[model samples]
Target: MTKLVKPVIDQVWLLRWWHRHQAQRLNREADAIRNGLLQDLFAVRRQLELLPGSGGLAAVEHLYQALDALGNRLSSPYLHDSLPLAIQQALADWPPQVPTRAELPSHWPAEPVEHTLLLLAVLNHLGQALAAQPSLPQVCAVSLTAGSDGQRLTIAANYASAVPPALLELDQSEAWRAYLATFDLFSQGRASSAHGATTLRWAFVW
Candidate 1:
Protein backbone atom coordinates (compact mmCIF):
# COMPACT_ATOMS: atom_id res chain seq x y z
CA MET A 1 0.00 0.00 0.00
CA THR A 2 1.29 3.46 -0.88
CA LYS A 3 0.14 6.89 0.11
CA LEU A 4 0.57 9.86 -2.26
CA VAL A 5 1.81 13.09 -0.68
CA LYS A 6 1.79 16.58 -2.22
CA PRO A 7 4.18 19.30 -1.13
CA VAL A 8 2.64 22.50 0.20
CA ILE A 9 4.35 25.38 -1.65
CA ASP A 10 3.74 28.69 0.09
CA GLN A 11 0.41 27.60 1.57
CA VAL A 12 -2.51 30.06 1.22
CA TRP A 13 -4.81 30.48 4.19
CA LEU A 14 -8.62 30.85 4.39
CA LEU A 15 -8.28 34.45 5.56
CA ARG A 16 -6.76 35.34 2.16
CA TRP A 17 -9.73 33.94 0.24
CA TRP A 18 -12.21 35.54 2.70
CA HIS A 19 -10.62 38.94 2.27
CA ARG A 20 -10.54 38.56 -1.52
CA HIS A 21 -14.33 38.28 -1.82
CA GLN A 22 -14.89 40.91 0.88
CA ALA A 23 -13.32 43.63 -1.27
CA GLN A 24 -16.53 45.27 -2.51
CA ARG A 25 -18.59 46.05 0.59
CA LEU A 26 -21.12 48.55 -0.59
CA ASN A 27 -24.16 47.55 -2.63
CA ARG A 28 -25.66 50.65 -4.28
CA GLU A 29 -28.99 48.95 -4.89
CA ALA A 30 -29.24 48.14 -1.19
CA ASP A 31 -28.25 51.69 -0.45
CA ALA A 32 -31.04 52.87 -2.70
CA ILE A 33 -33.47 50.68 -0.72
CA ARG A 34 -32.42 52.24 2.54
CA ASN A 35 -32.33 55.86 1.42
CA GLY A 36 -35.48 55.21 -0.56
CA LEU A 37 -37.55 53.07 1.85
CA LEU A 38 -35.89 52.34 5.22
CA GLN A 39 -35.34 55.91 6.39
CA ASP A 40 -38.87 56.94 5.45
CA LEU A 41 -40.33 54.40 7.85
CA PHE A 42 -38.44 56.30 10.52
CA ALA A 43 -41.29 58.79 10.56
CA VAL A 44 -43.88 56.13 11.32
CA ARG A 45 -42.49 55.69 14.80
CA ARG A 46 -43.96 59.08 15.65
CA GLN A 47 -47.33 57.39 15.74
CA LEU A 48 -46.23 55.26 18.67
CA GLU A 49 -47.25 56.69 22.04
CA LEU A 50 -45.46 57.05 25.45
CA LEU A 51 -42.00 56.37 23.97
CA PRO A 52 -40.47 59.50 22.55
CA GLY A 53 -41.14 62.22 19.97
CA SER A 54 -44.42 61.99 18.09
CA GLY A 55 -43.44 64.19 15.18
CA GLY A 56 -40.76 62.10 13.47
CA LEU A 57 -37.61 60.18 14.34
CA ALA A 58 -34.13 60.58 12.91
CA ALA A 59 -32.11 57.78 11.33
CA VAL A 60 -30.25 56.95 14.53
CA GLU A 61 -33.31 57.11 16.73
CA HIS A 62 -35.16 54.95 14.28
CA LEU A 63 -32.46 52.35 14.73
CA TYR A 64 -33.34 51.97 18.41
CA GLN A 65 -37.05 51.99 17.77
CA ALA A 66 -36.75 49.16 15.27
CA LEU A 67 -35.00 47.07 17.88
CA ASP A 68 -37.64 47.38 20.61
CA ALA A 69 -40.43 46.94 18.10
CA LEU A 70 -38.98 43.55 17.20
CA GLY A 71 -39.59 42.36 20.86
CA ASN A 72 -35.94 41.75 21.87
CA ARG A 73 -34.52 44.25 24.33
CA LEU A 74 -31.12 42.72 23.83
CA SER A 75 -30.10 42.58 20.14
CA SER A 76 -27.87 44.43 17.69
CA PRO A 77 -29.46 46.57 15.02
CA TYR A 78 -25.96 47.25 13.77
CA LEU A 79 -25.41 43.57 13.03
CA HIS A 80 -27.79 44.02 10.12
CA ASP A 81 -24.73 44.99 8.13
CA SER A 82 -23.21 41.52 8.46
CA LEU A 83 -26.40 39.53 7.78
CA PRO A 84 -26.12 36.28 5.80
CA LEU A 85 -26.29 36.52 1.99
CA ALA A 86 -29.69 34.86 1.64
CA ILE A 87 -31.38 37.40 3.98
CA GLN A 88 -29.80 40.24 2.05
CA GLN A 89 -31.24 39.02 -1.24
CA ALA A 90 -34.76 38.62 0.22
CA LEU A 91 -34.62 42.24 1.30
CA ALA A 92 -33.43 43.33 -2.14
CA ASP A 93 -36.50 41.71 -3.71
CA TRP A 94 -38.77 43.33 -1.13
CA PRO A 95 -39.81 45.90 -3.82
CA PRO A 96 -39.29 48.88 -1.57
CA GLN A 97 -35.84 49.31 -0.05
CA VAL A 98 -34.74 48.78 3.53
CA PRO A 99 -32.64 51.42 5.23
CA THR A 100 -29.59 49.63 6.53
CA ARG A 101 -25.94 50.24 7.29
CA ALA A 102 -24.96 47.50 4.86
CA GLU A 103 -26.10 48.22 1.32
CA LEU A 104 -26.03 45.34 -1.13
CA PRO A 105 -27.53 45.06 -4.63
CA SER A 106 -28.35 41.38 -4.06
CA HIS A 107 -28.43 39.08 -1.06
CA TRP A 108 -30.48 36.09 0.19
CA PRO A 109 -31.85 35.00 3.58
CA ALA A 110 -31.08 32.02 5.79
CA GLU A 111 -34.28 32.91 7.63
CA PRO A 112 -36.81 35.49 6.47
CA VAL A 113 -37.52 36.42 10.09
CA GLU A 114 -33.88 37.39 10.54
CA HIS A 115 -34.11 40.04 7.82
CA THR A 116 -37.45 41.34 9.12
CA LEU A 117 -36.15 41.45 12.67
CA LEU A 118 -33.17 43.49 11.51
CA LEU A 119 -35.38 45.99 9.72
CA LEU A 120 -38.07 46.36 12.39
CA ALA A 121 -35.64 46.28 15.29
CA VAL A 122 -33.59 49.18 13.98
CA LEU A 123 -36.58 51.50 13.72
CA ASN A 124 -38.16 50.32 17.00
CA HIS A 125 -34.99 51.07 18.95
CA LEU A 126 -34.85 54.74 17.88
CA GLY A 127 -34.63 56.81 21.09
CA GLN A 128 -35.53 60.28 19.95
CA ALA A 129 -37.03 62.09 16.97
CA LEU A 130 -34.18 64.16 15.56
CA ALA A 131 -31.98 63.85 12.49
CA ALA A 132 -29.13 66.11 13.64
CA GLN A 133 -27.85 63.37 15.94
CA PRO A 134 -26.67 60.75 13.50
CA SER A 135 -26.13 57.49 15.46
CA LEU A 136 -27.40 55.08 12.83
CA PRO A 137 -24.78 52.42 12.18
CA GLN A 138 -23.28 52.49 8.70
CA VAL A 139 -21.45 49.83 6.68
CA CYS A 140 -18.16 50.64 8.35
CA ALA A 141 -19.91 50.83 11.72
CA VAL A 142 -18.88 47.91 13.92
CA SER A 143 -19.17 46.87 17.54
CA LEU A 144 -18.03 49.93 19.47
CA THR A 145 -19.66 48.60 22.64
CA ALA A 146 -19.35 45.14 24.13
CA GLY A 147 -23.01 44.92 25.22
CA SER A 148 -26.23 45.20 23.12
CA ASP A 149 -28.71 46.68 25.57
CA GLY A 150 -30.32 50.03 26.33
CA GLN A 151 -27.20 51.84 27.52
CA ARG A 152 -25.09 49.50 25.43
CA LEU A 153 -26.89 49.94 22.10
CA THR A 154 -26.79 53.75 22.12
CA ILE A 155 -25.40 56.71 23.95
CA ALA A 156 -27.65 59.60 25.02
CA ALA A 157 -28.47 62.17 22.32
CA ASN A 158 -31.32 64.22 20.81
CA TYR A 159 -32.71 63.31 17.36
CA ALA A 160 -34.66 65.51 14.90
CA SER A 161 -38.38 65.08 14.30
CA ALA A 162 -38.81 65.90 10.67
CA VAL A 163 -41.00 63.54 8.67
CA PRO A 164 -39.70 61.87 5.54
CA PRO A 165 -42.96 61.31 3.61
CA ALA A 166 -41.64 59.31 0.66
CA LEU A 167 -40.30 56.53 2.87
CA LEU A 168 -43.61 56.11 4.73
CA GLU A 169 -45.59 55.51 1.55
CA LEU A 170 -43.43 52.52 0.84
CA ASP A 171 -44.22 51.21 4.31
CA GLN A 172 -47.85 51.10 3.27
CA SER A 173 -47.14 49.57 -0.12
CA GLU A 174 -48.42 46.09 -0.90
CA ALA A 175 -44.82 45.09 -1.39
CA TRP A 176 -44.05 46.13 2.14
CA ARG A 177 -47.11 44.17 3.17
CA ALA A 178 -45.50 41.12 1.62
CA TYR A 179 -42.29 41.94 3.41
CA LEU A 180 -43.93 42.27 6.81
CA ALA A 181 -45.87 39.07 6.23
CA THR A 182 -42.62 37.15 6.48
CA PHE A 183 -42.23 38.02 10.17
CA ASP A 184 -44.16 36.78 13.24
CA LEU A 185 -44.15 39.75 15.62
CA PHE A 186 -46.01 41.73 12.97
CA SER A 187 -48.40 38.81 12.82
CA GLN A 188 -51.85 39.03 14.34
CA GLY A 189 -51.47 37.78 17.87
CA ARG A 190 -53.16 34.67 19.16
CA ALA A 191 -54.33 34.52 22.79
CA SER A 192 -52.05 31.52 23.22
CA SER A 193 -49.13 33.27 21.59
CA ALA A 194 -48.26 35.28 24.70
CA HIS A 195 -44.58 35.02 25.61
CA GLY A 196 -45.02 33.14 28.90
CA ALA A 197 -46.63 34.59 32.05
CA THR A 198 -43.94 37.21 32.64
CA THR A 199 -44.54 38.69 29.19
CA LEU A 200 -45.98 42.16 29.50
CA ARG A 201 -49.48 42.37 28.17
CA TRP A 202 -50.89 45.48 26.54
CA ALA A 203 -54.43 46.73 26.07
CA PHE A 204 -54.93 48.08 22.56
CA VAL A 205 -55.56 51.81 22.72
CA TRP A 206 -57.97 52.53 19.95
Candidate 2:
Protein backbone atom coordinates (compact mmCIF):
# COMPACT_ATOMS: atom_id res chain seq x y z
CA MET A 1 0.00 0.00 0.00
CA THR A 2 2.83 2.48 0.77
CA LYS A 3 4.55 1.93 -2.62
CA LEU A 4 1.29 2.51 -4.54
CA VAL A 5 0.69 5.77 -2.64
CA LYS A 6 4.18 7.12 -3.56
CA PRO A 7 3.55 6.66 -7.34
CA VAL A 8 0.21 8.47 -7.12
CA ILE A 9 1.85 11.41 -5.31
CA ASP A 10 4.56 11.62 -7.99
CA GLN A 11 1.97 11.70 -10.81
CA VAL A 12 0.08 14.55 -9.13
CA TRP A 13 3.27 16.59 -8.69
CA LEU A 14 4.21 16.16 -12.39
CA LEU A 15 0.78 17.31 -13.55
CA ARG A 16 0.96 20.45 -11.40
CA TRP A 17 4.45 21.24 -12.71
CA TRP A 18 3.29 21.02 -16.31
CA HIS A 19 0.36 23.32 -15.66
CA ARG A 20 2.61 25.92 -14.00
CA HIS A 21 5.05 25.84 -16.91
CA GLN A 22 2.29 26.38 -19.49
CA ALA A 23 0.84 29.25 -17.46
CA GLN A 24 4.21 31.00 -17.42
CA ARG A 25 4.60 30.64 -21.18
CA LEU A 26 1.15 32.05 -21.84
CA ASN A 27 1.85 34.99 -19.54
CA ARG A 28 4.99 35.83 -21.48
CA GLU A 29 3.15 35.79 -24.79
CA ALA A 30 0.43 38.04 -23.40
CA ASP A 31 3.02 40.53 -22.19
CA ALA A 32 4.57 40.69 -25.66
CA ILE A 33 1.19 41.31 -27.28
CA ARG A 34 0.45 44.08 -24.77
CA ASN A 35 3.72 45.79 -25.60
CA GLY A 36 2.91 45.67 -29.31
CA LEU A 37 -0.48 47.25 -28.75
CA LEU A 38 1.09 50.07 -26.78
CA GLN A 39 3.53 50.77 -29.56
CA ASP A 40 0.74 50.92 -32.17
CA LEU A 41 -1.21 53.37 -30.01
CA PHE A 42 1.81 55.63 -29.76
CA ALA A 43 2.30 55.58 -33.52
CA VAL A 44 -1.33 56.54 -34.11
CA ARG A 45 -1.00 59.47 -31.73
CA ARG A 46 2.07 60.69 -33.55
CA GLN A 47 0.29 60.48 -36.89
CA LEU A 48 -2.54 62.60 -35.51
CA GLU A 49 -0.11 65.33 -34.49
CA LEU A 50 1.28 65.47 -38.03
CA LEU A 51 -2.10 66.30 -39.59
CA PRO A 52 -2.77 69.84 -40.90
CA GLY A 53 -5.49 72.07 -39.42
CA SER A 54 -7.78 71.50 -42.40
CA GLY A 55 -7.42 67.76 -41.99
CA GLY A 56 -8.09 67.71 -38.27
CA LEU A 57 -11.56 66.12 -38.52
CA ALA A 58 -10.49 63.50 -41.01
CA ALA A 59 -7.47 62.58 -38.90
CA VAL A 60 -9.62 62.16 -35.82
CA GLU A 61 -12.00 59.88 -37.73
CA HIS A 62 -9.07 57.80 -38.98
CA LEU A 63 -7.77 57.42 -35.42
CA TYR A 64 -11.17 56.18 -34.25
CA GLN A 65 -11.36 53.66 -37.07
CA ALA A 66 -7.88 52.39 -36.21
CA LEU A 67 -8.79 52.01 -32.53
CA ASP A 68 -11.90 50.06 -33.42
CA ALA A 69 -9.90 47.77 -35.69
CA LEU A 70 -7.28 47.21 -32.98
CA GLY A 71 -9.93 46.31 -30.48
CA ASN A 72 -11.35 43.71 -32.83
CA ARG A 73 -7.87 42.33 -33.51
CA LEU A 74 -7.14 42.03 -29.81
CA SER A 75 -10.31 40.02 -29.29
CA SER A 76 -9.49 37.60 -32.12
CA PRO A 77 -5.82 37.77 -32.96
CA TYR A 78 -5.72 35.08 -35.66
CA LEU A 79 -8.72 35.88 -37.82
CA HIS A 80 -8.41 34.97 -41.52
CA ASP A 81 -10.71 36.20 -44.28
CA SER A 82 -10.86 37.42 -47.85
CA LEU A 83 -9.27 40.83 -48.54
CA PRO A 84 -11.56 41.78 -51.41
CA LEU A 85 -14.63 41.18 -49.32
CA ALA A 86 -13.21 43.33 -46.57
CA ILE A 87 -12.64 46.22 -48.96
CA GLN A 88 -16.15 45.92 -50.29
CA GLN A 89 -17.50 46.09 -46.79
CA ALA A 90 -15.50 49.24 -46.12
CA LEU A 91 -16.85 50.88 -49.26
CA ALA A 92 -20.37 50.00 -48.27
CA ASP A 93 -19.85 51.65 -44.89
CA TRP A 94 -18.84 54.95 -46.44
CA PRO A 95 -21.21 57.86 -46.12
CA PRO A 96 -23.91 58.08 -48.79
CA GLN A 97 -22.82 61.58 -49.82
CA VAL A 98 -19.43 60.34 -51.10
CA PRO A 99 -20.15 58.54 -54.34
CA THR A 100 -17.60 55.76 -54.78
CA ARG A 101 -17.20 53.19 -57.52
CA ALA A 102 -15.12 50.13 -56.62
CA GLU A 103 -13.75 47.41 -58.88
CA LEU A 104 -12.60 44.32 -56.95
CA PRO A 105 -12.22 40.70 -57.92
CA SER A 106 -14.83 38.25 -56.73
CA HIS A 107 -12.32 36.42 -54.54
CA TRP A 108 -8.76 36.37 -53.32
CA PRO A 109 -6.73 34.45 -50.76
CA ALA A 110 -7.48 35.25 -47.16
CA GLU A 111 -4.97 37.04 -44.96
CA PRO A 112 -4.38 37.63 -41.27
CA VAL A 113 -6.78 40.00 -39.46
CA GLU A 114 -4.06 42.56 -38.72
CA HIS A 115 -3.15 42.79 -42.39
CA THR A 116 -6.75 43.47 -43.31
CA LEU A 117 -6.87 46.25 -40.70
CA LEU A 118 -3.74 47.86 -42.10
CA LEU A 119 -5.21 47.78 -45.59
CA LEU A 120 -8.31 49.42 -44.24
CA ALA A 121 -6.16 52.21 -42.86
CA VAL A 122 -4.75 52.80 -46.31
CA LEU A 123 -8.24 52.91 -47.78
CA ASN A 124 -9.27 55.41 -45.14
CA HIS A 125 -6.41 57.64 -46.14
CA LEU A 126 -7.46 57.49 -49.78
CA GLY A 127 -11.03 58.30 -48.91
CA GLN A 128 -9.86 61.31 -46.91
CA ALA A 129 -7.80 62.43 -49.87
CA LEU A 130 -10.85 62.36 -52.12
CA ALA A 131 -12.82 64.28 -49.56
CA ALA A 132 -10.13 66.97 -49.31
CA GLN A 133 -10.53 67.96 -52.96
CA PRO A 134 -11.95 71.48 -53.30
CA SER A 135 -14.68 70.23 -55.62
CA LEU A 136 -15.36 66.49 -55.55
CA PRO A 137 -16.60 64.99 -58.75
CA GLN A 138 -19.97 63.29 -59.09
CA VAL A 139 -18.19 59.96 -58.69
CA CYS A 140 -14.79 58.75 -57.44
CA ALA A 141 -13.37 55.40 -58.51
CA VAL A 142 -11.28 52.94 -56.48
CA SER A 143 -9.70 49.99 -58.25
CA LEU A 144 -7.85 47.04 -56.73
CA THR A 145 -5.65 44.56 -58.56
CA ALA A 146 -3.75 41.54 -57.27
CA GLY A 147 -0.55 40.12 -58.70
CA SER A 148 -0.48 36.67 -60.27
CA ASP A 149 1.73 35.31 -57.51
CA GLY A 150 -0.83 36.16 -54.82
CA GLN A 151 1.92 37.93 -52.88
CA ARG A 152 1.15 41.47 -54.02
CA LEU A 153 -1.92 43.75 -54.06
CA THR A 154 -2.47 47.21 -55.52
CA ILE A 155 -5.03 49.89 -54.65
CA ALA A 156 -5.67 52.93 -56.84
CA ALA A 157 -7.98 55.85 -56.15
CA ASN A 158 -8.91 58.18 -59.01
CA TYR A 159 -10.08 61.59 -57.93
CA ALA A 160 -11.70 64.16 -60.21
CA SER A 161 -9.16 66.85 -59.31
CA ALA A 162 -5.73 67.10 -57.79
CA VAL A 163 -5.67 66.11 -54.16
CA PRO A 164 -4.71 68.74 -51.63
CA PRO A 165 -0.95 69.05 -51.09
CA ALA A 166 -1.57 68.98 -47.34
CA LEU A 167 -3.29 65.60 -47.61
CA LEU A 168 -0.49 64.20 -49.73
CA GLU A 169 2.02 65.59 -47.26
CA LEU A 170 0.59 63.28 -44.58
CA ASP A 171 1.19 60.26 -46.79
CA GLN A 172 4.78 61.44 -47.40
CA SER A 173 5.56 61.91 -43.70
CA GLU A 174 8.26 59.83 -42.04
CA ALA A 175 5.81 58.46 -39.49
CA TRP A 176 3.39 57.25 -42.19
CA ARG A 177 6.22 55.66 -44.14
CA ALA A 178 7.59 53.95 -41.05
CA TYR A 179 4.18 52.61 -40.08
CA LEU A 180 3.72 50.93 -43.48
CA ALA A 181 7.32 49.65 -43.49
CA THR A 182 6.81 48.00 -40.12
CA PHE A 183 4.29 45.71 -41.84
CA ASP A 184 6.50 45.03 -44.85
CA LEU A 185 4.28 47.19 -47.10
CA PHE A 186 5.59 49.67 -49.68
CA SER A 187 3.80 52.68 -51.19
CA GLN A 188 4.40 55.50 -53.69
CA GLY A 189 2.32 58.39 -55.07
CA ARG A 190 2.38 60.48 -58.24
CA ALA A 191 0.42 63.35 -59.78
CA SER A 192 -0.08 63.77 -63.52
CA SER A 193 -1.93 66.12 -65.86
CA ALA A 194 -3.76 64.75 -68.87
CA HIS A 195 -6.05 66.61 -71.25
CA GLY A 196 -7.46 69.20 -68.82
CA ALA A 197 -7.50 67.28 -65.50
CA THR A 198 -5.03 66.17 -62.82
CA THR A 199 -5.04 62.71 -61.24
CA LEU A 200 -3.47 61.76 -57.92
CA ARG A 201 -2.25 58.20 -58.02
CA TRP A 202 -0.99 56.10 -55.11
CA ALA A 203 0.24 52.54 -55.39
CA PHE A 204 0.67 50.10 -52.50
CA VAL A 205 2.27 46.66 -52.59
CA TRP A 206 2.80 44.08 -49.87
Candidate 3:
Protein backbone atom coordinates (compact mmCIF):
# COMPACT_ATOMS: atom_id res chain seq x y z
CA MET A 1 0.00 0.00 0.00
CA THR A 2 1.31 3.47 -0.85
CA LYS A 3 1.29 5.47 2.36
CA LEU A 4 0.40 9.16 2.39
CA VAL A 5 2.73 11.53 4.20
CA LYS A 6 1.47 12.73 7.57
CA PRO A 7 1.47 16.40 6.61
CA VAL A 8 -0.39 15.74 3.37
CA ILE A 9 -2.99 13.71 5.22
CA ASP A 10 -3.42 16.39 7.82
CA GLN A 11 -3.78 19.10 5.20
CA VAL A 12 -6.39 17.15 3.27
CA TRP A 13 -8.26 16.30 6.45
CA LEU A 14 -8.33 19.93 7.51
CA LEU A 15 -9.62 21.07 4.12
CA ARG A 16 -12.46 18.57 4.08
CA TRP A 17 -13.34 19.32 7.69
CA TRP A 18 -13.39 23.05 7.03
CA HIS A 19 -15.52 22.64 3.93
CA ARG A 20 -18.14 20.59 5.73
CA HIS A 21 -18.16 22.95 8.65
CA GLN A 22 -18.74 25.96 6.44
CA ALA A 23 -21.41 24.16 4.46
CA GLN A 24 -23.27 23.24 7.64
CA ARG A 25 -23.03 26.74 8.99
CA LEU A 26 -24.30 28.15 5.71
CA ASN A 27 -27.19 25.72 5.72
CA ARG A 28 -28.18 26.82 9.20
CA GLU A 29 -28.01 30.46 8.21
CA ALA A 30 -30.09 29.91 5.10
CA ASP A 31 -32.66 27.97 7.07
CA ALA A 32 -32.89 30.77 9.59
CA ILE A 33 -33.37 33.33 6.83
CA ARG A 34 -36.02 31.28 5.12
CA ASN A 35 -37.89 30.79 8.39
CA GLY A 36 -37.63 34.45 9.33
CA LEU A 37 -38.79 35.63 5.93
CA LEU A 38 -41.76 33.31 6.02
CA GLN A 39 -42.75 34.67 9.42
CA ASP A 40 -42.46 38.26 8.23
CA LEU A 41 -44.50 37.49 5.14
CA PHE A 42 -47.21 35.94 7.30
CA ALA A 43 -47.33 39.04 9.48
CA VAL A 44 -47.51 41.28 6.42
CA ARG A 45 -50.30 39.22 4.92
CA ARG A 46 -52.28 39.42 8.16
CA GLN A 47 -51.81 43.19 8.32
CA LEU A 48 -52.81 43.53 4.67
CA GLU A 49 -55.98 41.58 5.40
CA LEU A 50 -57.15 44.34 7.74
CA LEU A 51 -56.60 47.10 5.10
CA PRO A 52 -59.51 45.79 2.96
CA GLY A 53 -57.30 46.14 -0.11
CA SER A 54 -56.52 43.30 -2.53
CA GLY A 55 -53.38 44.94 -3.90
CA GLY A 56 -51.45 44.71 -0.62
CA LEU A 57 -52.25 41.04 -0.09
CA ALA A 58 -51.39 40.28 -3.71
CA ALA A 59 -48.00 41.95 -3.36
CA VAL A 60 -47.32 40.01 -0.18
CA GLU A 61 -48.27 36.78 -1.97
CA HIS A 62 -45.83 37.67 -4.73
CA LEU A 63 -43.08 38.13 -2.15
CA TYR A 64 -43.97 34.75 -0.68
CA GLN A 65 -43.62 33.13 -4.09
CA ALA A 66 -40.29 34.82 -4.66
CA LEU A 67 -38.98 33.70 -1.31
CA ASP A 68 -40.06 30.12 -1.93
CA ALA A 69 -38.33 30.11 -5.29
CA LEU A 70 -35.15 31.56 -3.85
CA GLY A 71 -35.11 28.98 -1.09
CA ASN A 72 -35.31 26.19 -3.66
CA ARG A 73 -32.47 27.72 -5.64
CA LEU A 74 -30.11 27.76 -2.68
CA SER A 75 -28.52 24.41 -1.82
CA SER A 76 -29.18 24.69 1.87
CA PRO A 77 -30.21 21.14 2.74
CA TYR A 78 -26.79 19.77 1.96
CA LEU A 79 -27.17 16.96 4.42
CA HIS A 80 -30.37 14.98 4.69
CA ASP A 81 -31.91 12.92 7.48
CA SER A 82 -31.22 9.61 5.72
CA LEU A 83 -28.45 8.16 3.62
CA PRO A 84 -30.78 7.31 0.77
CA LEU A 85 -32.17 10.83 0.60
CA ALA A 86 -28.71 12.31 0.73
CA ILE A 87 -27.56 10.04 -2.05
CA GLN A 88 -30.65 10.82 -4.07
CA GLN A 89 -30.15 14.52 -3.56
CA ALA A 90 -26.54 14.24 -4.67
CA LEU A 91 -27.54 12.28 -7.72
CA ALA A 92 -30.28 14.73 -8.63
CA ASP A 93 -27.85 16.84 -10.64
CA TRP A 94 -26.16 13.90 -12.33
CA PRO A 95 -26.60 13.14 -16.00
CA PRO A 96 -29.78 11.24 -16.58
CA GLN A 97 -28.06 8.73 -18.87
CA VAL A 98 -25.85 7.55 -16.01
CA PRO A 99 -28.54 7.46 -13.37
CA THR A 100 -27.75 5.73 -10.10
CA ARG A 101 -29.61 2.94 -8.40
CA ALA A 102 -29.02 2.95 -4.65
CA GLU A 103 -29.75 -0.11 -2.58
CA LEU A 104 -29.80 -0.08 1.18
CA PRO A 105 -31.31 -2.12 3.96
CA SER A 106 -34.46 -0.88 5.60
CA HIS A 107 -34.01 2.13 7.87
CA TRP A 108 -30.35 2.51 6.99
CA PRO A 109 -28.28 4.16 9.66
CA ALA A 110 -27.76 7.88 9.10
CA GLU A 111 -24.07 8.61 8.69
CA PRO A 112 -22.38 11.63 10.22
CA VAL A 113 -22.68 14.85 8.26
CA GLU A 114 -18.97 14.81 7.42
CA HIS A 115 -19.10 11.25 6.21
CA THR A 116 -22.18 12.06 4.21
CA LEU A 117 -20.39 14.99 2.62
CA LEU A 118 -17.47 12.78 1.68
CA LEU A 119 -19.79 10.24 0.17
CA LEU A 120 -21.56 12.97 -1.79
CA ALA A 121 -18.24 14.21 -3.12
CA VAL A 122 -17.38 10.74 -4.27
CA LEU A 123 -20.72 10.37 -5.99
CA ASN A 124 -20.39 13.73 -7.67
CA HIS A 125 -16.98 12.78 -8.95
CA LEU A 126 -18.36 9.58 -10.38
CA GLY A 127 -21.28 11.40 -11.93
CA GLN A 128 -18.91 13.74 -13.74
CA ALA A 129 -16.82 10.83 -14.94
CA LEU A 130 -19.81 8.94 -16.26
CA ALA A 131 -21.11 12.04 -17.94
CA ALA A 132 -17.79 12.43 -19.73
CA GLN A 133 -17.88 8.96 -21.23
CA PRO A 134 -18.08 8.61 -25.00
CA SER A 135 -21.06 6.32 -24.76
CA LEU A 136 -22.66 6.66 -21.38
CA PRO A 137 -23.98 3.65 -19.61
CA GLN A 138 -27.61 3.70 -18.56
CA VAL A 139 -27.20 2.38 -15.06
CA CYS A 140 -24.77 3.02 -12.23
CA ALA A 141 -25.36 0.91 -9.15
CA VAL A 142 -24.57 1.99 -5.59
CA SER A 143 -25.22 -0.25 -2.65
CA LEU A 144 -24.63 0.19 1.05
CA THR A 145 -24.27 -2.68 3.45
CA ALA A 146 -23.49 -2.69 7.15
CA GLY A 147 -21.52 -5.10 9.26
CA SER A 148 -20.34 -5.21 12.85
CA ASP A 149 -17.25 -3.33 11.81
CA GLY A 150 -18.78 -0.48 9.82
CA GLN A 151 -20.41 0.38 6.51
CA ARG A 152 -19.34 -0.53 2.99
CA LEU A 153 -20.29 1.22 -0.25
CA THR A 154 -19.97 -0.43 -3.63
CA ILE A 155 -20.44 1.49 -6.86
CA ALA A 156 -20.40 -0.24 -10.20
CA ALA A 157 -20.34 1.89 -13.26
CA ASN A 158 -21.36 -1.08 -15.40
CA TYR A 159 -19.56 0.14 -18.47
CA ALA A 160 -19.80 -2.07 -21.50
CA SER A 161 -16.02 -1.97 -22.02
CA ALA A 162 -13.00 -1.28 -19.85
CA VAL A 163 -13.02 1.67 -17.49
CA PRO A 164 -13.44 4.97 -19.30
CA PRO A 165 -10.42 7.26 -19.59
CA ALA A 166 -12.29 10.11 -17.94
CA LEU A 167 -13.14 7.91 -14.97
CA LEU A 168 -9.54 6.72 -14.67
CA GLU A 169 -8.23 10.26 -14.70
CA LEU A 170 -10.61 11.28 -11.93
CA ASP A 171 -9.69 8.28 -9.79
CA GLN A 172 -5.97 8.95 -10.16
CA SER A 173 -6.02 12.72 -9.92
CA GLU A 174 -4.20 14.60 -7.12
CA ALA A 175 -7.43 16.21 -6.00
CA TRP A 176 -8.95 12.76 -5.59
CA ARG A 177 -5.90 11.61 -3.69
CA ALA A 178 -6.49 14.32 -1.11
CA TYR A 179 -10.14 13.30 -0.88
CA LEU A 180 -9.17 9.65 -0.37
CA ALA A 181 -6.74 10.61 2.36
CA THR A 182 -9.46 12.60 4.10
CA PHE A 183 -11.76 9.60 3.91
CA ASP A 184 -9.05 7.44 5.46
CA LEU A 185 -8.60 9.93 8.28
CA PHE A 186 -12.28 9.97 9.10
CA SER A 187 -13.34 6.34 8.64
CA GLN A 188 -10.11 4.38 8.53
CA GLY A 189 -11.33 3.73 5.02
CA ARG A 190 -9.79 2.60 1.78
CA ALA A 191 -11.10 3.09 -1.76
CA SER A 192 -10.36 1.11 -4.91
CA SER A 193 -11.45 1.31 -8.49
CA ALA A 194 -11.16 -1.62 -10.86
CA HIS A 195 -12.36 -1.81 -14.44
CA GLY A 196 -15.53 0.28 -14.08
CA ALA A 197 -16.21 -0.43 -10.41
CA THR A 198 -15.46 1.56 -7.28
CA THR A 199 -15.63 0.44 -3.66
CA LEU A 200 -15.34 2.29 -0.36
CA ARG A 201 -15.30 0.62 3.04
CA TRP A 202 -14.74 2.31 6.36
CA ALA A 203 -15.35 1.82 10.03
CA PHE A 204 -17.80 4.15 11.76
CA VAL A 205 -15.30 5.42 14.23
CA TRP A 206 -16.94 8.83 14.44
- Write down the TM-score of every candidate: 0.20, 0.47, 0.65
What does candidate 2's lDDT look like per residue over 26-129, in tens digits? 43454455457646756666786777754565665676566555544332232245677767766665556668777777877766444555666656655665
List lDDT for all candidates, in order: 0.32, 0.54, 0.66
lDDT of 3 at 116: 76
Per residue, candidate 3 scores C-alpha lDDT tens digits across 1-206 of 99976555566667767867865665566576578887799888988888864587887898888876565334325455677676667677677777677786667775666667677777777688678767676568777777775677777766555555666666677977776666767655766555524322222222
Candidate number of the best lDDT: 3
What TM-score does structure 1 among the candidates reach? 0.20
The per-candidate count of clashes, in order, stands at 34, 0, 0
Candidate 2, position 181, lDDT: 56
Q: So what's the TM-score on candidate 2?
A: 0.47
Q: lDDT, candidate 3, residue 22?
A: 67
lDDT of 1 by residue, 3-120 (tens): 9877655334343333223321223334444555555555454445446664434554766455443322232232345333433333333223223333332333232233334343
